[model samples]
Target: MSTPVVLIHGMWCTGGDWKRVRDLLEPRGYRCHAPTLPAHEPTADQPLRVGDRSLREYRDFLEQYIREQDFRTPPILVGHSMGALLAQQLAARIPVFAAVLLTPAAPWGINAAGLANLAPFARVLGRWGFWNRPYKFSREAAAAYVYNGLSPERQKACYERMVHESGRVAYEIGLWWADWGKTTSVDADAVRCPVYVVSCGADRLTPAFAVRRVAGLYPQATHRHYPDRGHWVIDDEETEEMIHGICGWLRPLEQRAARGQQAPR
Candidate 1:
């Protein structure tokens, strides 16, 4: 049987974001599933409380989902940015084939210096609940935050589809324990699954350097670098090529593992 693929979304995004990736993977005989986060809905009006959520919450959610489904083999957990960090945590505990960390956030934590440089007022807005205020979506700001590398038309459409994220989560990202430092507190060396990271050349939020840094942690893992792609590398014009590259990298490893499992009993 083919191994399952589980796609996890980054902060401020949902499983729907994986639709395109899923469409591309299914034809290859890989069954994919993307689960929604708690307190997040496409049309919800309620505010998400920070105290009610954590990376641990997401880890447990995925664990339970896997148990309930009784997946025969471990799933290949593909995570983007924040979701990548969560995927690492899950792989550390569960049996997983591999992790494709796409433009992943730093496993240590977001750089305090970098955060300060990009959004100097983030702390202030976080503390005062300014981010929680109901303001109409601004295409300009949304593009500035996520799609700086995309065209104006694409940016406009992306902004319309973007959902309102909890200010608490953004604030928590800056906090010490709230980030990967806390999540990876349990020795990262304990994580046994091979991890493959794909780095985009120009991702401002989760830069290529961040992806390179994790290499030392996963000495046995592989890393692929691409030029000029933004954080949304999967959505870029060269997306089909990128997906093929990923599949090429993954298919051989999977075939090797299958052969080993079936070897003379």
Candidate 2:
């Protein structure tokens, strides 16, 4: 049987963000699932419904979604940015085959703050009550940072798919220490699955420095970097190369499972 892979996207994005990834992985016999997070539905020009919703909501929705699938084997969890942090938390709470965190946002207690990382959020953070409302990055901010690796046309196309995110969730991630809920906390030691954490060299929001620290949380994590790609990875023409690289890493694990041998912890 094919291995199941659940692809989780981050803030300001829905399951649709994994189109490139799904298109590639499904043909290769992996069952890929990309579920939109709660409150990230397209509300176009309307007051955002993500009002004051916490990250815990997203985590609960995904955990339930994964359980309902009932795969013969635990699915591999692949997450990007904030979703990466969610994947890490889920790995600790559930049975997972493995996890691939792409340009992951730092989990609770890790400070990825530097000029490079914080610059992208400078304007977004300027707004009063930003911590209590829904927010989306301005096109200018996104083009300059999130989708910086893409051409103008590609960037424009990707930008069209952007969605509003919960300000409460953002605040939780940015100031995790102050969060009484500890929503972003991950018990790295509880995640026994093999982990692959990738970082984009030019990514301003979640830079390599923070990604490296996230990787260190897992004892068996393999760290890789794409010097050319940033957060808008799937939108870039070279996305196939990166997806193929990730598939290459997953294939051996799939093979071992097929033979009834568990991959190393």
Q: Give the number of the best model, judged by lDDT.
A: 2
Number of backbone collisions per candidate, in order? 0, 0
lDDT of 1 by residue, 18-106 (tens): 88788888898889999977655566553434223556676788888867877888788988877887787788888788788888766
Q: How close is each model in CA RMSD to the real structure?
A: 3.7, 1.4
lDDT of each: 0.68, 0.86
Candidate 1's C-alpha lDDT? 0.68
After TM-score superposition, what is the CA distance of residue 246 in candidate 2 from its true location, in Å? Answer: 1.5
Query: Using alpha carbons, what is the TM-score of model 1?
Result: 0.85
lDDT of 2 at 27: 92
**Candidate 2 collision pairs:** none
The residue-by-residue lDDT of candidate 2 on 1-265, one tens digit each, is 7779999998789899898889998998889999999878787543367857888889999999999998888999999999999999999999999999999989989997888667767776788888878777888888987888788888888889888888888889987888888889998899999999989888888888889999999889988898877877655777788788888988898889878999877
Off by over 4 Å in 2: 45-47
**Reference-based TM-score of each model:** 0.85, 0.95
TM-score of 2: 0.95
C-alpha RMSD between model 1 and the true structure: 3.7
**Model 1, residue 193: displacement in angstroms?**
1.4
Q: After superposing candidate 1 on the true structure, give the runs of residues whose Cα lies further than 4 Å from its correct spot.
A: 46-52, 109-117, 120-126, 129-138, 177-181, 184-186, 261-265
